[model samples]
Target: AQSVAQPEDQVNVAEGNPLTVKCTYSVSGNPYLFWYVQYPNRGLQFLLKYITGDNLVKGSYGFEAEFNKSQTSFHLKKPSALVSDSALYFCAVSRNSGGGADGLTFGKGTHLIIQP
Candidate 1:
């Protein structure tokens, strides 16, 4: 089955500093990479995705990710951090075809803490 792994349970960063949260994935075919953010007791919000183009992809809230085939990784990054950016982050993968209705699989979660 296609799956994603978020090794870290949490990340702490200072406000206005760059931040990152790591993710790795496994799938049968070429993986579709996605990043999502979640606030306290709220549903996840879409961040970015890597379908089949450039390795580096940008997304909402000034966030971005790099897709690395060799490392099987899709790490999320931001140039600067904000206290409002402190939230739960999730990495996801979708099958190339016919995997499921939505075909999305998500990681456990990673809590990002941005200190002011």
Candidate 2:
């Protein structure tokens, strides 16, 4: 079984400044990591994912994440954040079982507050 951890309950970042939401995971084997964001009154939207190959994975918006196997971290980052970027972010992971991926194990949501 795999699990994800988000150490911060909330992260405050100034608009136009770089933002990072920390995420770490524990699994028995190679893990499939993902990042998702949810706006007020909306469902979680896919942000980025780490399957294989590249260490840096880019996705929707200006968001990107670096997969650090050594540290077991997959922190979401954006070079510059916007006020509209404020949302609840979640980090999830699932085991990649040759056939397909298993159901995701998600961490407690982290509120990313982008101050104007």
Candidate 3:
């Protein structure tokens, strides 16, 4: 079984400051990690994914995450925060392609609030 944990229910940051949304996961075999963001009433948008490659992976909107195998963590980071970046962020994990019964298991979600 695979699972993800978002310890923080919300993260508050100033518009110009940097922000980070933490995430940790547990899984059998190699894990496939992903980040997605959702705006009010809109569908979730894919932010980034870590399948295999460099430890640090970059994604949309100047967001990046470091895949720490030893720690079993994938924490999302943004060098500079923006008011528009405020949204519901989710961290997910799966051992496979995330289909059928083997679908991706998502975290409860972290509300990123960027105050301008």
TM-score each candidate: 0.94, 0.94, 0.94
Candidate 1 lDDT over residue span 28-58, tens digit each? 9878789999988788899999989999999
lDDT string, candidate 2, 1-116, tens digits: 68899999999999999999999999988888999999889898998889899999999998999999999999999999999999999999986555663678899989999999
Per-residue error (Å), model 1, residue 48: 0.7
- Considering only N, C-alpha and C atoms within 3 Å, which residue pairs clash in candidate 1? none
lDDT of 3 by residue, 1-116 (tens): 78899999999999999999999999988888999999999999999999898999999999999999999999999999999999999999975744645677999999999999
Instruction: Indicate the residue-level lDDT of 74 in model 1.
Output: 97
Candidate with maximal lDDT: 3
> What TM-score would candidate 1 get against the native?
0.94
Worst 10 residues of 3 by lDDT: 94-103
Tell me the spans in candidate 3 whose CA falls farther than 4 Å from its real position: 95-102
* Local lDDT at 32 for model 3: 87
Q: Go through the candidates in order and give the C-alpha RMSD of each one to the true structure.
A: 1.4, 1.4, 1.9
- Note the Cα lDDT for every prediction shown: 0.92, 0.92, 0.94
TM-score of 3: 0.94
How many clashing residue pairs, candidate 2? 0
